[model samples]
Target: MGQMRLDTDPIVQVDRKPKCCFFFFSPKIQANRIVRAQLWVHLRPTEEATTVFLQISRLTPVTDGGRHIRIRSLKIDVNAGATSWQSIDVKQVLAVWLRQPETNWGIEINAFDAKGNDLAVTSVEAGEDGLLPFMEVKISEGPKRIRRDSGLDCDENSSESRCCRYPLTVDFEDFGWDWIIAPKRYKANYCSGECDFMHLQKYPHTHLVNKANPRGTAGPCCTPTKMSPINMLYFNGKEQIIYGKIPSMVVDRCGCS
Candidate 1:
């Protein structure tokens, strides 16, 4: 019950325009305990001439069983494109034996360029509450069809063509529980007075002062959520509760739990 050390440094901006960067790692296991996970990635080449391609995936974002088990995938091609600093070793082989009751799991990192396109994608979490797993919606089995190609003129019906089909349904009721803590162990403050919700804006609720307070004019600000000795589980209102610091939770209109 003693072996947990994780380090992550994410600073990416892939120039040629196509970017897809995501890093999410969740570690916290002890139900049947058999965990043994190790992942190390340190690639630095801000710019020298440019050349970087990396891909690592161990499932998540709705499962991809990639041939059932024994997964240990690695692909690295950092041929000294100059700015120096390279080390990529992604390893995960067996020992993930947690039989439920303490969940949060996902590991997916995909970054590419040098003709293959796509650049930026991150997902990290192997065990011991590294936390970063939120976004799940799956319910589609039958009758979902949309394939059209009509150039008309088949005789019998030429005047009965009036098509207008617009069916858009967006429903979100997942009600929070996302974990990813490592902002230097957390310590953020910037919400002087009235803050009910406004930190990523989305409609009619704005009233914040002190942007520097010359005559008191710049609006919106709220930040103060901290608590992580590794408890991780946030979404307090629909219950999944377990908070120590997430800005002290209270700023809603549809943002920040």
Candidate 2:
């Protein structure tokens, strides 16, 4: 999984009566590689009983002067809380900014429908490190390569055992990790058995090393040589739901040292 965090003090538009906070982020990652993206903001505690609606908007230049037009507003409900963090889905919005860099003016957040209630928000300039507004992005190069379990299967009880890959299913539910929303279980697989000089052709370097010091050198042991990832959707420690790929979760191949 890949993550990026950004923080900047937003420019407040005093002209607009309603409070408007603008945040700018530069995502250096490729547009097509982004699998998931989220915008996180910390909302200060409020005593008001009415729910405040936060409107997230994208800014697009409309005139030669320093003016922009807001498009595609994403409204999020802000409930009265005790300094809590809120997450907003920004995958499509971020993709547009990456594809068209010129249109990446930034995002605007405004509070509405609170009568006269004051919506206090934390910013990078005035808030603590943990309370600052930021973003988390998950990126993937392309389609994942599926690798099958190949090679000989051996029994540990047998005396003529050799290096091999064996089945090992990991049950998340059995482990009491209910936070994982998908894939209650998966094939993790394991490597075991032994490594002998008879299969030295598979690892030429190890063969050469053992050949040079045949008297005292130790032989290679069975181990996993390649691994693959698994896509997971789980709740983080902050209780935020996330969907990302966990790398090296599956053993793909087994070989001698």
Candidate 3:
């Protein structure tokens, strides 16, 4: 999962005095992986309580002029003399933008049927801390495949080689991984040792397979039999913070299979 604040202040068109606010965001992730995206805005307190109908639309340019294509609209009952935060689901819109970045013209918010005090749209520059309009996005990478690189730890001085787990500390800093927020270094144990016929007996299927076809099949080697995930807080390619579990990061047990 990743999140990003609004990069620029929302554009307000006031020549015709239309109750509209246009916003744009650069989503740097795959459309299929996006879990959700939201547009957060602050609705200022009104003089009296009333229902406000708001239309959220995407801008589409045409030969003559651009048109506002309505995507989804929201209706909210404004509280008298009280300010509130409004969040609009824009997951679908973000998907389109991610797939076709060139079509990102922006979105517009149109408020209708409001008297006295109209809806107040806050901008990042004008609004107070945390009240500025922004977009919150979340993405999922789905199931990650197991790493296939060499994860075995061995010693040169050791004479005996048996299936065993070794302490291996993974330091992200050594790789210049500044994106990771926590666990600069962690214990990600590796497995290393020899696997002979005696140890292969632990796994009945592997032993039988090796015994039946010794010349045709390759010999079993020491590998991780049990592994656990690690909770990681890091930034994605878009520079957004993501907190999730990375599977098969720590080897718990080693075996010949």
Best by TM-score: 2
Candidate 2, after superposition: displacement of residue 219 in Å? 8.3
lDDT of 2 by residue, 132-244 (tens): 45566667655656555455545445454788878788999998998775556777888888787677877788888887985856768888888898877566776444667
Where does candidate 2 have its weakest 10-residue lDDT segment? 13-22
Candidate 3 accuracy as lDDT: 0.65
Clashes of each: 26, 0, 0
Once fitted onto the true fold, the runs of candidate 1 whose alpha carbons sit more than 4 angstroms away are: 1-38, 41-70, 81-95, 100-189, 194-257
Structural similarity to truth (TM-score) of each candidate: 0.20, 0.54, 0.49
Candidate number with greatest lDDT: 3
Candidate 3: tens digits of C-alpha lDDT, residues 1-257: 34344433455433333323444555456788777677755566677788876667776644325677799878888778876656689898878887887776666764553774446454433434444455666666566555654344454565657767788899999999987855567778877777877766667787787678858576687779889887775656643345577899888667678
Worst 10 residues of 1 by lDDT: 162-171
Worst 10 residues of 3 by lDDT: 12-21
Candidate 1 structure quality by residue, lDDT tens digits, 1-257? 12333333333223322222233334343323433343433343333344566555443222332222224444555543322222234322223323431221334454455655433323333431322222211112244354342111112333422221111222222222132211112221122223334432432334323443568744543222322232222334322223343333221111121
